[model samples]
Target: MSVNIPDKGRIFAKKSSFYPSSCVTEILLALLGIFVFIQLFYYLFVFSKLMRHDPPTAAYAGAPEGVSVLVCAWNELENLRELLPLLNAQEYPLFEIVVLDDRSQDGTEDFLKEHADQWRHVRFIRIDKEFPHITAKKYALTVGMKHARYPLALMTDADCRPIGTDWIASMVGQLGPDKEIVLGFSPYYKEKGLLNWFIRCETFYTAIQYLSLARAGWPYMGVGRNLMYRTRLFFEHKGFYQHKHILGGDDDLFMNQAATRTNTSINLDPESFVYSIPKTTWSDWLRQKRRHLSVGNYYQRGNKLRLGLLSGSHTGTWFVGIATLLWGLFSHDTLLLQILGAVFALRWLVQLIVLGGINSRLDRTVNWLSFIGMDIAFFIYYVGMSGLILSRKKKVLWR
Candidate 1:
């Protein structure tokens, strides 16, 4: 007597019931499929809507508000030399430039002192020392915030250069009675090398996510490179008093606590954007990424969970999808093979549409030939960041 043999899929399905790990993998894939599909919807619909929104240069009509551009320099005399002149040239009628020379052993203080007389609107404060226990940036920024004469504080880095003369006006133009925080896009300058290209794409992708989330009415974080907030809000929230111990998060943590759907606005106008110099070496880039990732643990619980789900799903989609495809190939499971291939193709096509438009709007360059490799690289980046954030032995010192 012989038993009847089922088809390949039916045979695999029958065995999957008996194999506990296989059954668990199937269940996990099913749930992850649902999650990743939802995430794709967010990317396609919600973030695409943001891409379609008018650029702030054209849409925003608010009168020029009093704005202060805050830049903190730490051993960045060369950068400040190039950066200060650009700030002095901004066409905005009412604004001031305040620089916090955060204990720089370099000639930042002397450079500022030499040029301080020429730019009447520019002010510099020398911070040679701070409370040894506290992070220097928080202390330095607090001092600069106090020195700002304008009600609106626009913050950027010494290494960042404004693209256009209207950068200040474009940023502060979004401020009204209701909107107190302005999230501006900052992109890394495009360079010939692969590292710079990846950095540019990463920066643009990050900006798109944060700006889209803000547009979705779930504002979470902002990049300090081109972020603006009300001066009063800083004082109301006690000015980073809670997270002063952390080296980073001055911009993002403040936004996480203070920014609201009604109060926050995003501006991706080309003129509003700034160019940040990307790290040239692999080690430096990783160090910069580590510092940024370090503050993520301090984010609001809801935002943290939401962002975690997004990243987790991205990693799972690649990892488990590849594994399933491999298994299906060997097991002769044609349906599973087709399903995984179709999902990846569909998601990539949608991403091209959504991210393509965003890249165009933000003036970022992406190498389509290496998109998959970059995606995998980003997964590695996220993993490394996780290890760095979790390790107590490893510390991210403030720059």
Candidate 2:
């Protein structure tokens, strides 16, 4: 007697009975489902805030207030030379550029001294020594803020250049009567390299998180490169006093503590954007990222939980999704394969639409066609940097 056996196609046709039989495979499938759900939740709920946001093109309606642009520089003479003229030419009615020279052995001091008469709005404060009590960068910022001539303080890095003459006006205009903090976007100058693409993508994603959360009334962090706040707010918070011992977090950690939903506003105007020079080499970028990520441990418990969930789900979605898809392929389970394909397709679709909108708003550095590949690269980045992110030992350098 000969027994009859069903072919692969016939087995696949009976989808109901073709489910994974192995416990491990079933568990992975379940986890993939959960992660996909989380990803969708973030995309449809949290990130949608940014996607739906319509930036205003009109100038601010309220009366313009005097703004003191605060820049902290450490051996950045060359960058300052480029930045000062831009600051001096700001179209705002009343503003001053206060540069904090933090013990720069470079010709920054002489350059500022020589150019004092040339740049009408530029002023320099020299920091001869460091204070053991506070971190170097924070201490420098504190000194600069103390010496600011105006109540409104707009902070940008020495390496940053504003998009246009309206940078100060656009940023200060967002600070309505009630708001104390205004978060602005800063993108890296586009360069012809894979590293530059990743940097821009990473920056856009970071902005999406904090900016969207701010829009959603859970404001957490802001970048120093183009952040604005009242001088009173800084002094009230004691000026990075809580995390003074740590090297980084002049912007994020301070915002983490001081920024309330009602007090913080975001500036999305392209004219307000500040462009910063990116690290050209891999080692330089890695060190910069390490210093930045080291401050994540100091965020509030709720902020940490929210960010951890978003990032954790993002990482899981890629890893678990791939594993399940591979399992389905090896097992020749047509239903499982279809389910995985649908999950991935849904994620990519949502990412394309939402991130595509965001990319258009900022610099269009991320190629929508290659977004999934870039996302997978970020997943690898998260895994690779996990150790540094979770480290408790404080980074000691401020440069």
Candidate 3:
């Protein structure tokens, strides 16, 4: 059978464009200019708003009675050596600590059993090797949740360290009778090189974007490093029921489906923060980030909107920079381009000035000169990997 094609003017004509090349270029440049302005304004507004209010003061200094702490690990024995002592050292009077071992080959089971007697609330679980899926971390946490005896449940990875003895109390204190989820801040441990600094900066900036959104009405996600929720909420949401098959993002993805504005709370206390060593090498960091981004497609609409706005800002910034350079090359109006460049400088200067205080508090190194290059590298990597993440249809194992 022969298929009839539509008329040229009716179909192909609409796809063809004969606008003057100069006009088309100008239109594109104008669109780029608008995008850059919007990008600058959005972050500027968020930064200014976050600065306008003081970080919330914790209402309590310790986890309430009957709080269960769950730490999940795979081949993370040495991390537990320091981690358990830290937990035992918590100022809180009442809390139970449990560690889930996901078929670890690093003798994590023996290590936990060896130190199991040191703490009053310590417990351990060793998973059998015959488990069905590669999502061991979530499965292990599920096991811990099954054994949890407290009304409140808090989760932190074995590799992470709490900032202070009051960490548990501070995190759980944010919860109230009505609150079901509490999102806490976590930053990278201070490190030695440019790579470490860049990692912390990228992580911190990404976190600020999401956590600030949580502070606003749209609460969609949280980091697992220092996440707490009610035990009832966990069962009510079915505890990663829908996302269990995905190898990563058991934390934020679960929060994406579970948290709401009325039931969620944000804990910004510095003393309550948890710090994990940032991946120091490019390859290690890349693999870790790839695992995290693999679950991005599973986020809800609000999550997508927030991330979409961020991606647009990055694209617009590059478009503006390139367009400005080209305008200087081909246009006769050199003075107008110079004026625009000055305004752009002012905008970035304001940003750096605000970031100065934030960087100081987080205790991450700040090298404005180096960040210019780091930011370019991060933007390119994130944009390139975003396509791979968005198109993924199968469950990917955690790297």
Top TM-score prediction, candidate number: 2
Q: Write the per-residue lDDT of candidate 2 for residues 1-399, one digit (tens) a residue.
A: 998887978778676455535665789888998888888898889887776687545355556678899899999999998999999999988899999999999999998898867988989899999888888889889998889989999999989999899999888777766789999999888888889988988988999999999988898899999999999999998888899998789999999989998999988888899999999999888888988887888899999988999889989988998888788888877888888888898899989998888788776756787688778888999998997666665444687
lDDT of 2: 0.87
Better of 1 and 3 by lDDT: 1
lDDT of each: 0.82, 0.87, 0.74
Off by over 4 Å in 3: 1-25, 61-63, 360-375, 387-399
- For each predicted model, how many residue pairs clash, with residues at least 3 apart or on different chains? 0, 0, 2
lDDT string for model 1 (1-399, tens) is: 999886999888878766965674586469658767876977886789777887444333445567889998889999988998999999877889999998898887888888888987788889978795568888888998888898899999999999989998888767667889999988888788878877977887788789998988999999889999989999999999888887888889889999998999999778898988888998788777777886787889989887888888787777677778777776676777777778888887887778777777877556555556666777777777778767763565566
Cα error of candidate 2 at position 338, Å: 1.6
**Taking the tens digit of each residue's C-alpha lDDT, what string does model 3 give over 1-399?**
999988888665555543343564567567656766765765676644554445555566444467789998888889998899898788776788988887889989888778799788788888875456537777888888989988788888888999889988887778776788888778887778877877777777766676667767677678888899888888898887788777787788888888887888877677778998788788777667767776677899778877777677767667666776676566555665675677567656766765655555554445555545655766676677777566644544442
Clashes of 3: 2
Q: Give candidate 1's TM-score.
A: 0.90
